[model samples]
Target chain A: QKEVEQDPGPLSVPEGAIVSLNCTYSNSAFQYFMWYRQYSRKGPELLMYTYSSGNKEDGRFTAQVDKSSKYISLFIRDSQPSDSATYLCAMSAVTGGSYIPTFGRGTSLIVHP
Target chain B: DAGITQSPRHKVTETGTPVTLRCHQTENHRYMYWYRQDPGHGLRLIHYSYGVKDTDKGEVSDGYSVSRSKTEDFLLTLESATSSQTSVYFCAISELLAGGFHEQFFGPGTRLTVL
Candidate 1:
């Protein structure tokens, strides 16, 4: 099984709607979880990050991690056309030295105005 | 914007040619990573540097080699570029903060085409 799994969604939605993107991991050791957004032909930019198992909010973006269920999610409220990009989930285990990160296939999102 | 810079934003090289990509950072981070993005595979690690003169191989480091002579620079060299190596490359720097695996900041990607 893959260490991390995410839905590669080209999900299309209207502007102002809420969007939820999720990822699941097989390793319970992942203590650091992060979400990154990428535009076409561009490198990914960190969106939101959470430590251990809890919710972290930054402006219009929220990141949730449920260690018990091995699931992580990023919720964007009042989504805008500017949010149209690929969302990626990345996690790292404290045991694996302190640098190597495991990434999931990004979920593409498009918000139409 | 972690003060990371990647050179040669776009390049097209012939297959079997040697190509080297550079990642320069002003953050003085201890951890530097090299990754490539493709259609199905989101981002795969190619190589990483722990500190000056300290480097390690990643999952996809078979066709690549890296060096970190200084704290601010990391270089990834493709010995013999292949069509399979035609992908967008990204460089990242991780700070000691952010819970062991801090938010990794990325550079603007380098688009490479091996024809």
Candidate 2:
């Protein structure tokens, strides 16, 4: 499939724990859902942004969208160590007029201290 | 970051020579993008622009080539470089606020190395 399915996680929590990241999609007009945060070499940064489905908080980060199970999530409640890095999941759907973004193959967070 | 700025953050060419990567923006967003981050393929969109001689062609636009005359500039060209076109190159800017909420703001990457 691979319209967008993230799980390239190196996931290794410990700081404050409670970190969960996921993504699953097959199109269906992906209405927009993003969460990016890359650090190693730097570049992707926009942490959490939702439009379709519900759930969106911006403190410890929490963005969840479930457009009828297309699924999308990013929660990192108490994590620390500056919240490691690499966690990307982007989606877009405007077609003709323009709006292109479909990326997923990231999820490598390691907040350990 | 947001205001974007990428230019020879680091480069090391060789493959076939000819490489130009520059994306500068001072906001004035009207949509302008060109991404490429390999290692398993995460961010991939090779060109975009919606004004100033408008442009298009993404999804790994074969070998790459883009140029937006003005509008804060956006140019990515690798006429002959290979080595799978090295990686790390991002430049984004979006604006369509209100309801449609399209927000993309990046640029602090450009680490080419085709040898």
Candidate 3:
């Protein structure tokens, strides 16, 4: 099985709706979880980063990691049209650096007015 | 913003031709990586370097090769490009391993189109 799994969703939501994107993994070895946002024809930008498990909040975004279940999530409060992009989840273990890390297919989010 | 720049920003070449993409960083970061993004595939690592003269292959290193003779420069070469090799390439740098904490900074991608 792929180490990391995420829904490649074209999830459409109305503006001001709360958006949540998630990914699950089978590798308990993964210690670092990251969320990246990529606009069409652009590079992936690091959005939220978390280590191990727990929740981290920054402004309107929150990232949660559950090491026990190997699940991670990113929540966006008050979504905007500018927030429409592909959300990719990446994770790595301390020993897997040379192995190229693991990435999910990325969920496509579109917040419309 | 990443203190990193990717040259050619855009490239188009015929299949079977040799192509080189350059990634230069001003951050002096020790770790450099090359990744490609294809439709439906998040991003796949092609190669990475921990330091100068130190490089290693990633999962998709079949048609690609890389060299890092200098600390701040990492170059990726496709000896004989194929249509399958056409994708957006990204260069990233990290001061150290994430350790489940540190973040890797990414440069604007170079769009490569092989026809």
Best by DockQ: 1
State residue B56's C-alpha deviation in candidate 3, in Å: 0.5
Residue-wise lDDT of candidate 3 within B1-115, one digit each (tens)? 5788999899999999999999999878878899998877779889999889999888789999999989889999999999999999999987554343556777899999999
Measured against the native two-chain assembly using Cα atoms, what DockQ does each of the candidate structures obtain, in the order listed?
Answer: 0.78, 0.32, 0.66
Consecutive 10-residue window with the lowest summed lDDT within model 3 chain A: A92-101
Tens-digit lDDT track of model 2 for B50-103 = 888799898889988988888999899999999988888988888777878687
Q: Which is better, 1 or 2, measured by DockQ?
A: 1
lDDT of 1 by residue, B34-114 (tens): 999998888999999888998988889999999999999999999999999999999999877633556688999899999
Per-residue lDDT of A63-94 in model 1, one digit per residue for the tens?
99999999999999999999999999999887
Please give the TM-score that candidate 3 achieves against the real structure: 0.94
Give residue B21's lDDT in candidate 1 (0 to 100). Answer: 97
Off by over 4 Å in 1: B98-101
Comparing 2 with 3 on TM-score, the higher-scoring candidate is 3
